[model samples]
Target: MLGRLNHVAIAVPDLEAASVIYRDTLGANLTQPQALPEHGVTVVFIDVGYTKIELLEPLGADSPIAAFLAKNPSGGMHHVCYEVPDIHAARDRLKKQGARILGDGEPKIGAHGKPVIFLHPKDFGGTLIELEQE
Candidate 1:
């Protein structure tokens, strides 16, 4: 089951600009940019007390973020992550409930260095859901 709202991700055409908006303009604290090659994104996390804000930029030409940017040129909310006590158990339960899991149905290391899985957007009312192990 979901534990807490982990972080909300926003795909951006320019990570620097986005970070500036959150950090300089909004006066939010941000982490240094982290390149997640496996996920095909470079991310910056903004500390917002109760929850974090993740800014994602395409890492390469084939990056999924790149594809998303292609479709939504200005970029947008990409996904929302929730913490789960056990990702495997959560995956199985969701599967049994007819929720579609994405990417081979296996957990991968996420931004927090925790096991994570993505659920299909269509299965969740057009909003992509990410489950991160707590």
Candidate 2:
């Protein structure tokens, strides 16, 4: 089942710019920034109660977020992440219930460094879905 609202993912052109805005304007405390080389992205986190706010900026042309930005231009909210008690179980249930996963495989380390997977928007009322488990 669901655990908590993990974080809201925002796709931006630059992680540092996003971090500055979130920190200076919104007063969000940012976590140490890191680049996920395997994923081709640089990400930063901002605390939001139990949930966090995640900013994603592609580090390479082939990154999924890069493609996402191509479609969104100025960029916008990318996905909503939900915390699950069990990732494998949640992923399995979502698939059995007809959710189309973005890729065929197991959940992997995502923006927040948590095991995560993306469910196609078609099955989630048009909102891209992200599942994460600690």
Candidate 3:
């Protein structure tokens, strides 16, 4: 059900600082900061050779990223996104196998303007998993 690796998300306390580290230090080309109010994050995407790295900052105090940063003030890896040909099918398969889906178990519009869903971390070895429709 999983396709190629999509972008890996990193929750950062400061998105600009994190973008600079990737842009100046690592010599990576990054996308402009995009505020996603629905998702409660402002994101910047760094383009690597094969995949991308997403830098996320909380849009508000109630943002999930804000909660994540409270636990690790320095910021850290947030989730790994994988592409799937059909998100609905993949979701149903995972659900039948007892995998927990985040939110209302419905696909949301992601950074790439594609349908995406997040799976519970505990079900996948303590690492949050994001499934994006290809």
Alpha-carbon runs more than 4 Å astray in model 3: none
**lDDT (Cα, 0-100) at 6 in candidate 1:** 85
Weakest ten-residue segment in model 2 by summed lDDT: 104-113
Candidate 1 lDDT by residue in tens digits, 26-105:
99999999999989999999998778999999997679778778899988999999999999999999999999999899
lDDT of 3 by residue, 1-134 (tens): 77999889999999989988898898889999999998999999888856789999999667988888999899999999999999999999999999999999999999889999999999999999999999
Q: Which 10 consecutive residues of model 3 have the lowest summed lDDT?
A: 45-54
**Colliding residue pairs in candidate 1:** none
- Runs in model 2 deviating more than 4 A are none
Output the better candidate (2/3) by lDDT: 3
Q: Compared to the true structure, candidate 2 yields what TM-score?
A: 0.89
Cα lDDT, all candidates: 0.92, 0.83, 0.92
Cα RMSD (angstroms) for every candidate in the order listed: 0.9, 1.6, 0.9
Clash totals in order? 0, 0, 0
